[model samples]
Target chain A: MINRKSAAALIIGDEILSGKTLDTNTQTLAKHLVRMGVTLQKTETIRDSVDIISEAVKRLSESHDMVFTSGGIGPTLDDLTYEGVAKAFGLNLLKHEATIARMHEIQPNLVLNEARLRMATLPEKCDAIWTGGLWVPLVCVHNVYVLPGIPRLFSSMIESIPSDHFGDVPPRERKILWCDLAEGDLAATLDKAAKEYDVAIGSYPATNNDSKKLYRTMVTVEGDEADIVIAAAEQLKGALNARYGTV
Target chain B: MINRKSAAALIIGDEILSGKTLDTNTQTLAKHLVRMGVTLQKTETIRDSVDIISEAVKRLSESHDMVFTSGGIGPTLDDLTYEGVAKAFGLNLLKHEATIARMHEIQPNLVLNEARLRMATLPEKCDAIWTGGLWVPLVCVHNVYVLPGIPRLFSSMIESIPSDHFGDVPPRERKILWCDLAEGDLAATLDKAAKEYDVAIGSYPATNNDSKKLYRTMVTVEGDEADIVIAAAEQLKGALNARYGTV
Candidate 1:
């Protein structure tokens, strides 16, 4: 493989934990990081409570190269990510003038009430990076990047972060071996090949989408080194003795 | 509010971390626990590693009343939940005759290879709960329940667990106030009503599904008692001065 910087994601929202909303941010961040050649080490989904957010931020930021936090940054009552992140770093929240200016630019005649002003409040020593002609700023405190819960805003903000910000990792090559053999029957061969190869080999059973199994089992062998990855997959395919025949 | 037990979920799989798969298990468990009147407090997603699983199980199980783990229990090489659970409890995995019998019943004349036998081998203190005519067991080690990652099997296995297993909690009532006001405009009012009433009130801005906004903002007032829940929603509606009027 190649040397790659690792990152973790912290998703903050009560809607996710209560089953009221499905979390798409983690997946978005994951796929984005993959394209940037950064490995997403871990992800956590938690409620919007300040204590929980603060603790998770501290924990995740300590372990990984950087941490990306999604949600809980709106002007609503439940939005407490700024306060939580500030508390995590022993800093304070300050109303950022740039954020208010951007907000006024978007709404033109926005009423600068306490409710609207809450969006301008950010952690001390943090940078409010604006983008996409949207008023919402992607707040960065140290290595922790705080983002909004809205999917549109989250996706654009993540995309705007420069690829070099995560250092550089060359893209990896991947190959797949498909077979009619069920996961149980295909397990032993995969185990053997994985031990002999330096690549990541994963076996996935075909899932029933709407109770209909539409595909056969698939085994993936992937690594930054293309030659070894391809060789590993080729070896597995050649040695396979499929009771149900190869797919 | 009525008394309720809280639970945490630990989801394990490399595919999830690598963005190769989207996780629906956390949502499934969250919705299921909601039906049982149990509160799901937190959810964590991590790579498929023995040490990571073992540590997460210990930490989550200690903090919450119970914990549910999804994935890494298959017969594949990467399946490591049993080993992790055993390490967490200082127990050893032992081969179970019942699981082998079930495997035979499902795929008669099945070979009991090491890979297949791995499915029958479980933690010493764990209880293998069978359901839905599937050979895969819902292995429970004390307050931690390990389940398969596949959505279809995860859904069915979670349903088979008895309600009383989580202890009894009367159902909670929920009421909602829909409005055309944007989230920034609705924030202050929600903050006021949530503080006044002893209820969990959450404000959600409308999302753009396929880049099209299909609905307006929604505010939920929920608690164990119906009287106060409805009162909270109604009070917010009466006090609401919607610039766009209430939806």
Candidate 2:
């Protein structure tokens, strides 16, 4: 049996907490995960403190099907994500010879300072996915995938991760149409449509300058099959239109 | 005594959970609060659910010295922040006559939909701080300031919030410079610096392409006072430099 339930993103870095960096990774991952039929339940940002990072890693790893941690894997003293992650799984940070060699290959002229080489350290028994660069190394520990915090690198590394390795869940296509209708007014109709189609319907309202304001309701219907989503969306649109006219 | 310690940000939106919009409000507010000498301890994101919104409002209002809320105060069905906040405080959501009059003055040709008019409603006993378009009315609930989620609007509203509202506490800053040192190698020193300063000092390492494999270390000292921070930074920098010499 395949676990098809939960996912989480643990963003690690002082830059996040200090507000020096805005976390785009959480949103990006959340959207992507949802598209992949994975429910992203929570996203947390913890400082680069080892205790906090370790605790977060342990808790999230145990609870979620997969955990993606971004940031704090750099060659800096403040970069404690690797060590914290290693400690979380009770693994020693051993130098992975292949990773070091890859690092050298990418930047042959690169200095091999102990700090720079630290990027090659991985938890024992962990699978290191080398999206190699001067930035942090992306590695997978248990169900957790650690990537760099830099938005560009983070996104690229995430894309490089094979979706099959995470799980073989069917992709779900979700779409939304907005309307100007009071939630209370549309609640019963939406409920009927939801029950009829066995789909979830969310009704939200948006007000406007006219006393006859519009509700920007998002009627999202999702399923493994594109036809199912489209059919549900059409039903909702028709019901809403019948009541409020063209939105 | 005025407690000038804790601050919080309330992210109000259904779109956030629906995955329609990525929240930048929390990050922006957190950064501002940190720089203003206020410790941003918690952030809450709630949907347009009235009960949840009200509960969050009451709880967070009582907990933090300053609270910044973004989204859901717009003229839309999903925008129920004003009503929820009013209910949370057990106050009436009365249309501020002045605000209504102002709205009328600004958009005389504008149709006054009940939903749009709802935007002018204010919780009794709260102060209103107008930000952005003359047509929109933004307000504050106790220490909680309600702002729109549109990046520009949110930022503009933030400007109206008095900077000195949280009072003054000096921020500590420390800088560290080390060459050819890995974080693990300097763990003991880093721990000592943190203990000595009775604050947080972060270590960041950067790699180079030198023959000696040089790495630059960034030690950040954070405290409530400048002197203690500078002293700790100087001590750590001196020790590291003496051990490794300048790169």
Candidate 3:
């Protein structure tokens, strides 16, 4: 049996809950993690409260193999991720000389004000994961990886993550079938097909917009057995095609 | 002092976690709920597992004044929201005759297969919030309101929800100050200003894109006291300008 790794994301932001900003970090992390064979179990978006962030971090870290947190790591008043992580692990916050040195190296003319220097302070005993090219590094405190919420920065930092972060399990293979029939029309056929395979089947019916396909279904087959996953995809295709015309 | 109402949203779907679908329902509900004096406290996205869904619903409902759930309430095998909601409330699942009648009324020639008819299976005791003309209605089980995931249907259903659903708290007044200062530069100013006012002040710094603004910070002052919210916005604007030389 393949040992599957599980992960969860903690998106810390008041902007997200207030509808002032749309959070794409969760989706980005999910896609990246899924492609790496890590099952993203749950994602929670909470307000930027230090106590709540600390509690959630500790809880998620205990339950999941790996916990990725986005947002709240910025150099601002609302950026309390470091403090939260410190509280969760009962570690003291310390200013790292390396981070400060790197910051100066990257932004030579930038003022090193109290606010800017705040980024150097992080949870004690945490390793900085940097790609050498980027000045900012993602902080890893135990099983929790603290990443900035900015989409570009988050993606860049994630790319620097080591290959072993996802563990030894193979990535999932997905097959999608776009059907002309509405989800209601294809319900029975999908039900039968889903029961036949041990794969994860998802049905997403799009709202009537100007989109070409009325509905789309994705079949994810991931496990140690590659042949079974491929075979299931073939069977699903045949079944769906037979019932409703494929788009 | 104003009594603040709180809400949380549960987005249930495997597709969302798989990165196949982007959930806008959370934001849609957040924007609408905020206008009604309801502060959306948190939002969670979990796979379509009955146990997980039920647990999340129960937990969220207890913590929040109102809970809105989106997705997994469709007519498919994976559509397990009704079951989850029922389990959360410890209520028996019954085929709601009203829902069945509405389903048939909407899709007259549609064949009501067992899978399709599954949409009609709701919790034993619940109120259906419906618009006069729309056949599909949002299900309300205790403090949890079940709305479908589809954007169009979810929005339409939410519109039918009674105004009293968000409680009698007076709507908050909001004032925003857009500044060109980076979040790091204005952290101390924002922190000091936030403590001085009763309003909820949030500083959101946007990532630099191709847009004209290199950096954008949104200072949001929201509270029942219009005078305080407005004064804080003015104070924040002055502080930011003095500190960063506003763009």
Candidate 4:
């Protein structure tokens, strides 16, 4: 199966930076990308200023194969993601006829006012992917996927993306071992296993839900090969003397 | 009262980027910073690589008056934040006697293993804020505050910091106006108030919690001064002709 291997997320909003809003888009995008075997390397949350947005989009787009931006794609004055993206590519913001046509197709009685028409103005060099019968198409400019800030819409747009649109990936696997010892106590054991197995292992101090389950540290072993990942997890489980293999 | 005017958060972790953990420290920092009239300009969540951590910390520190980092400050092999910070300033990682002493003070019979002792090794030049009767000091190197990844510990460490520790403040006030109209419909009104009143205004589409309250769009008005924020909210409240001021 074709999949994107490396990705980055850029969350654009003043509300998020201002603490007026909590961004769930990063996690949503993360879960979806992980399922596609895409490793989300970094996420940058910045204000809605066009200057800030353009600079960040340019920087992130250059580093990762696929870049996903959430928020500030609406019709408001604060919605400057389209302009920022256009600026990032040194393009012009032009009214998109397809988006306008799709808007009418979705809502026959829609009043195409100045504000509503503002949504049609997008980067000159972008393609719009209309999916799931939604009027607002997923705007693609280069490697960046410009999505709306709304949780429901953003998630649906991501879900509708075809896998081939990405790059490539090997089927990855994850295994978690629950250990009662403190993270420090399991550190040396984790280090030895990680060095020997040559797999991605992470030790996390448990909290909230994990704590409720009487779990202390959750050691995760992951790799592109299932056999290797499993072998590493087993080694760590035995080395740490962990009883519960809770992957 | 002194308060830092601008802040940035650097979240260092593999679990967060790998979608294994959701980061709540940014919001916790934002809320606290906003209360002190400090604008959290940006938040960057990256992997637990030393190079990535060092580069991000250095860049963010230069941009903001205060920088806070969450995660990657443990005893495991993956814990590389301290090394990253020291590398950022070209400083050496040295053992701190004060941290070791405090650890003994907290737990007299504790074993200072190589793993646990790793926590005591901080940057060469930094102040250790011993607070909340906790052995682990809040390591402050330059403008960056290196904090633990655990949500509870991170929150308590932040709470323990005195207000005077910051630069300056003028008591921020926030007011939200809940309207039963779409965000697009309220766009013009929000824009006008923002331009006219010279206050920070944000328009958010109602989420799960706000939707349960029968609210559609939440327009927030905030400023360092209370009177201007209220006046702007009042103007927007009247201009939008919304009867419900939810804040």
Write the residue-wise lDDT of candidate 4 on A139-172 in tens digits.
Answer: 9999999998888898889988888765446546
Quick one: best DockQ, which candidate?
4
What value does the lDDT take at residue B208 in candidate 4?
Answer: 59
Predictions: Cα RMSD each: 3.2, 7.6, 2.9, 2.3
Worst window of 10 by summed lDDT in candidate 2 chain B: B205-214
TM-score of each: 0.93, 0.69, 0.93, 0.95
Specify the CAPRI tier of model 4.
medium
Residue-level lDDT tens digits of model 2 in B1-247: 2245777677776456436567787777776776677777656556566787788878878987877778777654456888888888888888788788777888786666665676777788778777546655568777777777767667667766666776776543534354456564675677777776766766644423223334555455676667776677678867775232322
lDDT tens readout by residue for model 1, A1-247: 3678889999898788877778888888887887788888888988889998999999888898889999988778888899999999999899998888888888798788888899898997788777878888888888899988889889999988877777767766777666677787878788888889888888878777522244367677878888898888889888764222222
Clashing pairs in 4: B2-B168, B3-B167, B3-B168, B4-B167
Instruction: List residue ranges in candidate 2 displaced over 4 A.
Output: A1-4, A58-63, A86-101, A104-112, A117-125, A132-137, A176-247, B1-4, B12-22, B42-64, B75-77, B80-102, B117-127, B132-144, B170-223, B227-247
Q: Residue-wise lDDT of candidate 1 within B125-234, one digit each (tens)?
A: 67877887898888888899999999999999999887788787766777666676777777888888889988998887877752224336777777888888778888
User: Is 2 or 4 the stronger prediction by TM-score?
Assistant: 4
User: Which ten residues in a row are the worst by lDDT in model 1 chain B?
Assistant: B238-247
Compose the digit string of candidate 3's lDDT tens values, residues A1-247. Answer: 6787999999999888877778888888888887788889999999889999999999999999999999887777778899999999999999888898888888787788888777889888899998656677799999999998888888888878987978956777666566656677777776676677666666776565525444454334334467766676677667664223222
Once all C-alphas are superposed, what RMSD does model 2 give against the true structure?
Answer: 7.6
lDDT of 2 by residue, A174-222 (tens): 6566666554355556657667775545444442321333444544565
Error of 2 at B55 (Å): 6.9
For each prediction in turn, the share of the native Cα contacts (below 8 Å between chains A and B) that it retains comes to: 0.70, 0.17, 0.72, 0.66
Quick one: RMSD of model 1? Answer: 3.2
